[model samples]
Target: MKFNNKIVIVTGGARGIGASIVQHFINAGAIVHILDREFPDSFDVGGNDSVFRASGDVTNSDDVKSFIKGVVTKSGRIDSLVNNAGIIRDNMIWKMDESDFDAVIDVNLKGPWLMCKEIAPIMREQNNGRIVNIASRSWLGSAGQSNYSSSKGGIVSLTRVLALELGKNNITVNAVAPGLIDTPMTRSLPPEVFKKLENTIPTKKAGHPEDIAHAVAFLASDESKFINGQVIHVDGGKSIGANLH
Candidate 1:
């Protein structure tokens, strides 16, 4: 109940880390609205009347504008916006297809950009808002994920830029860069590859979706009002630099 009567918007919240984020906000007493391309049949909004779900492509400007308008109409104001919608098209630069790169960049970078553009005016008018963008630790570097890495790196930059622009309006913009979290996406990796990744973590284990959600919830709360333009890595110290001994 930390966010009683608050209005929060989470994009790509139908499953995995996004889904976990929606649940956390809902549990914290926020009126949570989710925008996703599609909701799985098994996905549930916990029967919470405060929870709303809409299907739309985050990359579509028309779709993003419509969703924002709908949320404002129903909730009157938006207190927080979580840009959690992202997609990965992993490949070495040489092996990657142009279309794959375009698809990943469109959804991962462009989508968040569109969402922020639509929400900034609302937050500025209110003179208060929280924006938690879901970036990735891969922004640092990843061998087979050139497109994804670049897109996330762009998000990191975008978060910083928005923070500077929106600070005067009392809006805080931050990002949570998750490492190896156990989600459907990661679960798709071959067992050997997944296990290898887990072992590479400083903690010798992959993080859970809730771990990322916890960090996001903190960044989205009033307690973090003073914190802005920062990237919080919920990556089990994987971003701490390699172990050299």
Candidate 2:
């Protein structure tokens, strides 16, 4: 996947899975732009002239719009967008706080909506673009994750709708639903919990961020022109069904 000179925007790319996507695109020769609230101390966005970093809140429409505008002004055009910005506030429905629900929905769902709303026009005008939304396997449903699941489910629907709305303009919109990828957030889980979660996966192992990045790169590439409005699961068969064994 040679993305030489391609301008790619990745949200929440300061660390973890988002950071991996940024690195992958940069390796593929895409001019990668990152938008995140804060970057990690170990974040090594160095050694790559194609990498650009910015601080912004995806949940803020003004911030999102301004960031996109700045990227366009500097890069002239955006070839692909990775809506990888998301938050998780897990709680059982009965115990969930309204603030937690609002926060998750705002960041996970509304953020992507705003991004697509702003970038859609630019892609349409240019008559070419690719959108890879980072949804989750949890969208299928998960206990104590009502809010998070709902938001990702909305992203799945949004991806499909955007594909239909933007297809005529030669744009492809798809989603990568990752399952149990090892990231900072997942690593924070209790060892017992993490082990149990790994056991549940058919592969009996967690995925790496690079696994998801590879899928995003494919969907973002021109080769996937015919594949639109689809959700590709990068979950090592976890989405197939529960182990039940």
In Å, residue 210's CA in model 2 sits off its true spot by: 0.2
Model 1 ranges with Cα > 4 A deviation: none
Query: What lDDT tens digits, residue by residue, belong to model 1 across residues 1-245?
Result: 39998999999999999999999988889999999999999999698687999999999999999999999999999999999998887878999999999999999999999999999999999999999999999999989999999999999999999999999999999999999999999998999999998888989999998999999999999899999999999998999988542
RMSD of 1: 1.1
Candidate 2 deviant stretches above 4 angstroms: none
TM-score of each: 0.98, 0.98
Question: Which ten contiguous residues of candidate 1 have the minimum total lDDT?
Answer: 236-245
> How far in Å is the alpha carbon of 55 misplaced in model 1?
0.2
lDDT of 2 by residue, 132-168 (tens): 9999999999998999999999999999999999999
TM-score of 1: 0.98
